[model samples]
Target chain A: MSTPYVRRFDSFDRVLHGFLMLSFLGLAATGLPLIFSDQPWARRMTGILGSFEVAGWLHRVCATMLITVFAVHLSRLGRRLIFQRDFGLLWGPRSMVPQPRDLTDAVGHVKWFLGLGARPRFDRYTYWEKFDYWAVFWGMGIIGASGLLLWFPVFFANVVPGWFFNIALLVHGEEALLAVGFIFTMHFFNGHLRPEKFPMDRVIFTGRVSLEELEEERPSEYARLKASGGLAALQVPPPERWLVRLGTVIGTTAVSIGLLLVGFILYAVLT
Target chain B: MRIKHWLAFFSVLFVATLTFVAAKGPTNIPMKAPPAPSRPAVVKAPPEPANDDCLACHGDPDAKSDTGRRIGVDPAKFTESVHGALDLKCVDCHADLKKTTDFPHPSKLAKVNCAGCHQEKVAEYDRSIHAAARRQSAGSVAATCVDCHGTHDIRQKTDPKSLTYPLNLPATCGRCHGDPDVIKQGHIQIGNVSDLYKDSIHGKAVSKSGLMVAANCTSCHGSHDIRKKSDPDSRVFRRNIPNVCGSCHEGIKAQYDNGVHGIANGRGNDKAPVCADCHTAHQIQRADVASWRLDTIRECGTCHADKITTYRDTFHGQVTSLGFVRVAACSDCHGAHDIHGKADPRSTVAPGNIVSTCRKCHPTAGENFAKYDPHADKHDKARNPVLFYAAGFMKWLLLGVFGVFGLHAVLWLPRGFRERRGQAKHS
Candidate 1:
């Protein structure tokens, strides 16, 4: 038996998420040309970007959108924590601590991979996922704060020593290198490289889960929902099941087409 | 029926509210006109008094100064002055009329700046190092015109009493410039040039003990047209140094350019010596027996110490210090302005041409002596390869030995907390 999978994100949250993703991607695309300016490819990239002034305006607009989305997300989180009484999910005392058993499990997993032991039991969220999420949060905070400092440099010039600007430049560049490296190497490997999840992960969009998936992947959360008397909602009636299935098919098809269009446009422009 | 009635009534109310809001929006209020400014009132005042009566007493020719010097009011001579030429009255320069009891005397006066009149001469003077110091020490009794020329009876060279007259120039100019007390007080560094020039090769050819016809104050400073060295139009500019000196030392300048020192200076090397550095201005003498017995290299070595030390360490200096006439001082390999570097295609000491520049004196000179940089000291091992090899090898061997020892420290040193944690668990 599985627990009911409530829609996790509101409409506002989904819209904000989309805006953030678009702007972040736009900034990265526009900024890379300026970074590798000495290369011949940079010239071609700049040309495709249509004049630096227009590109600059587009980048700033995107940045503003990203910041607005971040503010909205923060407000939602604040409301959830204060008014909605959902602080238990976040700011709850964490139990995902490094323990003797966790160490043993980690060692066993490594051993299993080496053909020296059986695979260890795992829980709902892996240590690596927690690390990646926290890293992104820290990266966003640092990059955002440094960017604000750089944006209004004259305000700080009177209070801060000149050397701080040099330090800010160094930190901005190195932090960017770390973020890009992690995104391409570790995040891509973890998020998109698994065989079953290989071409896509649709759960973020649908905000749903199957009984078998809940049992296999999130047994602890499933058990909690069952204890909380939410399991009845998990069993969909025959008529509602068809409706949900139809919704999923249309939604997935629309999303897939949109993603392909974006990819094709990008390919045409970049080349 | 009630729902339909309420919806129709509310729709009519909404339309009425929308119409009201539209009526209140965007009225183009006319701009208010700005107030006109009032004109300023003019204030009238009294007229200036006349000074025609004052000129009566000042126009007298028999008037004498309190110190008994004749204060002859020479209108003609005064008119020739720049202030007079500019139509400036004597009263413009003088003030303090209340205390005066004399006629043809300045009622009051301020010290005159001749520069206010003679602007071009002042500009030329200002750019020279002498005028550069004037701002700092303006009140110092330094080289003013009256110090060389008499104040009341100043004249051109044609006048017998004129300080610039050919026979009298050196003695007249030297009187203040050569006085040990005056020179010391003024901190003038061109040491006793008036005395020394009186005895130079050119000096001996002239008639008097203290005067030279070929060279005098005006010979270098120019009669009345003396210009500053900073001006490119001036004869004494650095770029024109070789040619200026060559006017008298033609044979020497030709030979000197082939020498290394002249070659460097011609290429704009500030470290290279100018003609004045060794022989010196004001104290110049012939490089004959009286001076040759003394080490010429010692004089040149004041600035070229490393070269001096390097040359001393060589066989050339060993013979030269002992008074060998053929030994080099600085007039070897680097000709004057005609000099080009070894890198230049036309260079006399270029690898292809070095044999010839050396062959002028050393017919059998090998390439070894020609390749050596004469300015370099033997102890400067970085430039001297044999010493560099010996020192560098020993230093690096020691560093390599120490580096091997340091690796032991690095490899086992905690190896960061992550590796330490793993190691502890394994143990």
Candidate 2:
């Protein structure tokens, strides 16, 4: 029999994730050159983009896309809480929110990595996954706000002092560097580069996880679902062949570009 | 007195008037027209010696003077010359031989006086450094008419073959100015300006592009009236530099005239910069060139010492320091030709216009964006406390995060290796 699949993300979530990845990559590709404008490669990259002005335009466009994604994601959470009365999203084993269990999981995972203990069983979201999700909230808060200030300096000047623009520039560039560095390296590793996920983990793109993967990676959630008779409800037929291929193509392209950008950033920093 | 003192006096007065009339001759007649304005009597020029008369012997290729000097003159070349084109005869310049009827004129003829026809030009040349040196009796080998204009083959400057043509002037002047031996012998203080001009934008335009409008050696330095740069009347004198360059760059000159530096220069401030101060006198390249754009910041810094120190601290300055033009240079915001003080509303960097100046490069820039000080001194707490603190905070934040995470990554490497080994063993 074909490997059974369980839905990890809905179509809406998958599409939103796709937009998020694209916009984030676009922002990095355009913004990194400006921050490292002194590098020889930076000029070449800007030249490829037509000019620094064109790159600036592309950066703002991507920033708008990212902000829209952030807003939509927030509205969905708001709708779940207020309109749908879904309290489970805020606090539960299935919730993305961190809990005491996450602390224990992190400790157990480190011990297991050190060969001192058995691996911890994950629920719907692991501690690292929760960290990644929340880091976006933190990153978006800093980078997005400062980016807006920089984008509308004239409008903001009426409210803030002139030196605030200086601060905004500093914060915007530094926070962006931190975000890009983290997302490209640490996040890439956890999402796709770890030995278990070696080449990739396409669940984010295809919106499905194989039954075996669901069982092995999230045993606690699997046990809970099975006990509650929710496991069968979550099960679905395997994803279509073309859907998987699409996911592979998108995933591979993104991973390659992200790694290449990382290479550029490292070279710029080291030199 | 009273025409007739008496009948007896009438006779004597009549004789005296007649005697005066006789002494003045017919010119005193009442009917005679006023004597024509006195003029030197015009004597007809003596008939010029025919070219055939002189060329019979002088035209021979083997013709030589009694002193063994080559006296040969190619008849064909002279016929094609500027003076020949004017149909001048051989005796026109060689006036001493005008009356010589002998088959072989005396070899010792007076030196030809070009001043006879070109009095004004010769007078101008007499006041020049060349003529002054020639007259010094120190026997300085200085250029005269024949040195630049060929003896018999002289062509009009309009002709491309002429040595004084715009394209050929550099090399013609370079013959003496570029010669190391001439420079040393003449004690010329200005060394090899010819080579410097050849590499300049003006030189390249003239020689390589064949642009007739481009300035040649005689353009700034007058052809016959060239003076030392130290002379106040000189075209290249410090005070006259603007007007000299302005003769060609009119629009730039107008803009510069209204600029602070130009105004200061007008007020006789010797320190105020002129075009040559930043661009240099010779070896001037196009301002748009990357090297020139990058280097001009340092040129401006030579005077604005405090401003440059602060500018060097900014991102734009750092990028330029690395020799890139991708970012704004000083002139990008501050006007290049018409730069003004910030207090002046007309200034690009003035409070009212700074946003628009920034918008040149950063199109979306606004008042707040313009507030990002390009020359902010982070160390000057009194002037820029916010920048000082912000920069300090960022420095530590970067160090802190990298220090922490870098250690974590390092620590995790050993475990990663152990895990890989364990997995291999288990497999």
Against the native chain B, each candidate's TM-score is 0.48, 0.76
Candidate 2, residue B186: Cα displacement in angstroms equals: 15
* Residue A48 lDDT in candidate 2: 90
lDDT of 2 by residue, B1-427 (tens): 2332243234434444554567656543222221211111122344335667688789886788879999999888887888776545577678788777776887788987777767777888887878877888567878888778878888888889899988998889999988998888788887888789899999999989999999898888888878778878778888788998999999999999999989988888989888898788877899888888877888999898988877765557755655567788888888888999989999998899988888887777666567678777767788888877877887787677566545545545566666657667977
lDDT of 2: 0.80
Complex DockQ per candidate: 0.00, 0.23
Residues B100-197, candidate 1: write the lDDT tens digits.
Answer: 45544453366555454455665666655445455568676556655555543445565555676766777786786778887886677766767886
- The model with the greatest TM-score is 2
Q: Candidate 2, after superposition: displacement of residue B197 in Å?
A: 7.0
lDDT of 2 by residue, A1-271 (tens): 7998999899998999999999999999988876776677777787798766687799999999999999999999999999999999989897898999999998887777677888799999988788778877888998999899877766787788667766677677777887787788777877887666767788887889988878878999989998999989888888888998998999889988888988998898887
